[model samples]
Target: MSTGRDITALVRPPRSYFVNAPMGNNFGAAGDVATQSRILRAVLALAVEARDPGLILDDVLQWPAPFAFNPAPATPEAIAKQLRK
Candidate 1:
């Protein structure tokens, strides 16, 4: 079974999922670091405010590291280069 299916199978009883679209998509036309950060913070706040016991599949939370790049790139190629060693 696929990892996604495995995960889906593990979710029992009450289940909740949280997902953040790619930072670029979340930011929209003029998406920037500030905008992306704001959206991420909002999602975190919601998860914290939620009182019920449920899973939150927050993709942003799984980010390898924090967003610290200055003058963020505008394309996938640029972003990939930035992530390289």
Candidate 2:
């Protein structure tokens, strides 16, 4: 689960963001990709719903993974830089 601070930041941010963590013990397990994809799709749907409802003031972020065994570190600034490419 994402920390309260992280979720707060997501909700406070002006732009949309997608946060991907790691699956639990099921990491690398069979059908993990399908499961993760489904999770992402659900999040996307929620984001769409929020937008349709004009709830842009709320958080439109996705936390696809509940656990991260060896996660990479990337700050929001770094991600923004990448998006400029």
Candidate 3:
């Protein structure tokens, strides 16, 4: 399963699953077992049932909230500022 649909399309694996979640939380939220299990089962089923090559089955599950990622410190000055945070 993957969260990067563009990357997955470029890679073009024989069988893959796409989950609409944050990068780190591909299966589901950190502690939501039910959602994770459902996504896992769907991925597994896609692996078994997908017949065409480069087929990507999209997950129906949705992330509950907006995901915001902090920008990485790219420069020395930025790094120093981030350290202060």
Candidate 4:
């Protein structure tokens, strides 16, 4: 459910909404207010409803079309090594 492998989920803490997104734009696509608000509301609703701890809301926003991103190189190790520099 996590976008970038949230280590915190191992402990299962409060206010955790695991989504399929990048680091910054966790809720929805940047500049897309409607989607953002909707995501926020969903999380808020979970927060309000959740009584016990260890609540991880794993949800995926149904994007209209494919949300595109910069293509990654075929090999991750090569790109990761370059980024480390």
Candidate 5:
């Protein structure tokens, strides 16, 4: 499965599943079992049925919740504090 289409395309695997999700949350959102299951099943089914060598399947799924970037802490100590929590 790939979250970065550019990188995946360069590597060129036999068959790949591409998800338009965050780098880490590639299978859907956190705690969303239904979406995760669907993505897994689709990939597995494609693996079995795909005939082409450089086939790339784009997932129609989107993140359940809107995404926003959180501002980073100004200081290293503040970043460490958040991580230690």
Candidate 6:
């Protein structure tokens, strides 16, 4: 078993680095090398710093700048339409 899609919530990983960005480009925004490295380092550091298991730490940086992302479903019908499609 455990061959299907790996759900995020279900899989209790020992260490997790949650980013504010989308699933596509979570490390950084576009070509932001600095931002990417920062995130990576933080995650790597967690491996050593983290003593407890199954800990999910949120990204320290709160992404301020707006980047092109999938807009949230505004209406109930819109949400249903997306689910249907």
Candidate whose TM-score is highest: 3
Per-residue C-alpha lDDT of model 2 across residues 1-85, encoded as one tens digit per residue: 2223355455654333233433342123346686556545655665565543222332233445465456579989999999999
Clashing pairs in 2: none
Query: What's the candidate order when arranged by decreasing lDDT?
Result: 5, 3, 4, 6, 1, 2
User: Which residue pairs in candidate 3 have backbone atoms (N, alpha carbon, C) closer than 3 angstroms, thus clashing?
Assistant: none
Q: Highest lDDT, which number?
A: 5
Model 6, 1-85: lDDT tens digits are: 0111134337867767777665566786788999989888988898899987767777866567755546675899887889998
lDDT, each prediction: 0.47, 0.46, 0.87, 0.71, 0.88, 0.69
- Residue 46, model 4: lDDT of 86
Clashes of each: 0, 0, 0, 0, 0, 0
Error of 4 at 38 (Å): 0.3
TM-score to true structure, per model: 0.30, 0.30, 0.77, 0.60, 0.73, 0.62
Better-scoring candidate (TM-score), 2 or 3: 3
Q: How many Å off is the CA of 84 in candidate 6?
A: 24
Error of 3 at 16 (Å): 1.1
What is the per-residue lDDT of model 3 for residues 1-85, given as tens digits with 9 covering 90 to 100? 7888899999998898998888888989989999989988888888788889999888887678877666775999988999999
Q: Give the range of the ten consecutive residues with the poorest summed lDDT in model 1.
A: 20-29
Question: What residue runs in model 3 are displaced by over 4 Å at the alpha carbon?
Answer: 68-71, 74-85
Regions of model 5 farther than 4 Å from truth: 64-85
User: How much RMSD separates candidate 1 from the native structure?
Assistant: 12.0
Model 1 has an lDDT value of: 0.47
Lowest lDDT 10-mer window, candidate 4?
1-10
Candidate 2 accuracy as lDDT: 0.46
